[model samples]
Target: MSAELPQPSTTSLADRVKNILIQPKDEWGRIDAEPATVAGIYKSYVVPLAAIGPVAGLIGMTVFGVRVFGLSYRPSFGATLSTAVAGYIAALIGVYVLAMILNALAPNFGGQKSEVQAMKVAAYSCTASWVAGIFQLIPALAWLAILGLYSLYLLWLGAPRLMRVPQDKAATYTIVTIVAAIVLFFLVGLVASSVTSMFMPRMPLPGGTLSVG
Candidate 1:
């Protein structure tokens, strides 16, 4: 009898998924649209950062007051857990929405345009932020650096994929983006803090009163 014919081996679906997860970008199809992409990133960053900083600061201050001042607790365990979960969901949605809107806006300019793929990239980066937030208790300094690096990595990965500018343009845009974002945030923080404080109406009881907030 002739030797049995060899059977074709097939990769299972799980194996396919694993391969996809671990797959690297195709070097041959690489894009160099950094300028437009980086500009897109900055556009997304500026608005959301402007919006969220105050909310974050308020949350931080509220948590600290609760712990340090030992304010009377009204919320039940269920309520607290629900609020935390809700907050996480809200943040994720907010991040995604911010990316989508700005990406839609990126293509209007001559120097910059949006790549649809960037939406996925931005989502992934924000997802990383969500995951890393779980480790916020990690030694404060180290955690800060880790969060920052993760953010930049996501931005780099997601932004350029959707941008279609030349290498020099991309690099320049990226640099300007970082620098301008830092400066912009400083100004926003200064302005937001001042404006919010002045207009937000301070609660009178400096020492102790019912804030419920």
Candidate 2:
């Protein structure tokens, strides 16, 4: 058998988050050189961070409730909890799917594909968006999560280096990958919603049943 690859150093999660968000160019360089495994990345980074949005949104909706047309409506706890769990699972699957897309499309954009490298790009580039999930704590402020669009900028910078794409083609690569991700997540959302609805009980509201958006 071949020799084992060196394991990545134990970098604190907070430091990694700060570096990726504050100085992604430098962070990408480190990410490209480090040895990482799919399990390690998911356990150390993706699992925890990806939970932020779903968990926060769960608390926001169930605790504070949603107000529409000067009326307050709260979804049933079972529905809210189930939706949160489904969304969280979807996020975990989404990252892996995105990495696959990045690796598959790498050669088309003049980049050499490496699964680990694609994963690093996919996982780390999402730091901004995951961090921004804190906005979900207050439904009204959830719109501020738009700031997470910075992840697109991070993807633009990291893809060329990690995927070995030429700078000239990086923009196209990033855009295509993003479009693919949108479609993938959209489908995933539909499936999750459909499945959740099948098991979710109908909750009566003042005028209608509580809808989990």
Candidate 3:
């Protein structure tokens, strides 16, 4: 709640991380003061990792010894831990982008400032990414299951937040924001995946043409 920069709970690093990584939608203040902008709400959602990412990665690596040598809990069948991590990262980026879109478009549903509130929504989303990534180092279909659950849970949580619009337009905003955000996310994901697919390497055909077609 520091005015300098809207911060998550300052109790401790772990607690702050929890706020950023899980409970990201709420803010101590309804509006930001210093920036004299409405976007603080959205950007606050982005700021948590301003400190957590590097520090947490360092601590995690140090404590875990930079390798999962004996992680009995991790799945060990198909893809290596690295690939699972890669997939998780991909999903994270997709979700973050979706959150941004929601922040921008959903606010219309609520009549709130999209620019600032995006930060909170984005933070709230990391919860699913981390929860799935918990054992993502393992390679199985489990990641898919977790991802599905994460998507559902976000919508469930977000629906309420989206509805709390000013001027008493709560119900309309809730349905519009929640539904629009989800639709836009999938649309964005398809566009993104297609673009990435274009850059993917393709094997040569029997006649030696490299066409993905």
Candidate 4:
């Protein structure tokens, strides 16, 4: 068996986030060298970033309020809190699901299969999107969350080093993984929305209290 990739003695979270955005090539090299476990990766990276969107959304929607399709709206505090917690948990699970899908699909895409490596790629490549999620703080700027598109580039660069995909197969691998992730997320969101709706209190609408979004 090969030697383990050494974990850095002091990898600052802020520095890692900055490096991944500003210096991804070098950053991915560093990430590819670091040893990690599924749980460790969640504690170190996924858990924190996953909260960015929901936390920001909670504050923005509840405290500051925002226009929904040009109509002023604010989710009740209870609704916001429940939604935030549910979304945060969903985000964490989404990463793990994506990692599993990536690992399972690797061999079919001319990539060496390794679940640990796939998890790392799934966790780190998502940094851009999680960071972009902060735009949730300002609903108007939420469209800028499209910046997560940058992750596609990050994944393309990291695939060969992290997932061991051949250069020619990297694009195919990335595209496949991304598509799978989108579908998985959509399903997760649908389920979460359904569940949230079932328990969430209805708010007064133009005419009466109706539980609708």
Better of 3 and 4 by TM-score: 4
> In candidate 3, what residue range of length 10 has the lowest lDDT sum?
204-213
Candidate 1 per-residue lDDT over residues 94-186, each given as its tens digit: 544545543554453223544434443444344334434433232222245245345544454445444544554555544443444345435
Model 3 spans > 4 angstroms off = 1-13, 16-96, 155-168, 187-213
lDDT of 2 by residue, 41-157 (tens): 988999999999989988997777776666556767777787888888988998899899999999999999888889899899888888998898998999999888898788888
lDDT of 3 by residue, 79-136 (tens): 1233323433445465456556556665675545554445444444444444443442
Largest lDDT belongs to which candidate? 2
**By the lDDT metric, which is better: model 2 or model 4?**
2
Indicate the TM-score of model 2. 0.87
> Which residue runs of candidate 1 sit more than 4 Å off their true CA positions?
1-66, 69-75, 101-105, 108-115, 136-149, 175-213
| Candidate maximizing TM-score | 2
Q: Compose the digit string of candidate 4's lDDT tens values, residues 1-213.
A: 998764632678999889988999999888877777777888888899889988988887665564544445555677678778888888888889888988898888788888778888888888998899899888778799899878778777776678888887878888887788778878987977875675443443242222324
TM-score of each: 0.42, 0.87, 0.46, 0.84
Stronger candidate by lDDT (1 vs 2) = 2
**Model 2 misses residue 128 by how many Å?**
1.4
lDDT of 4 at 91: 87
Q: Candidate 1 overall Cα lDDT vs. reference?
A: 0.39
By summed lDDT, which 10 consecutive residues of candidate 2 come out lowest? 204-213
**Overall local distance difference test of candidate 3:** 0.42
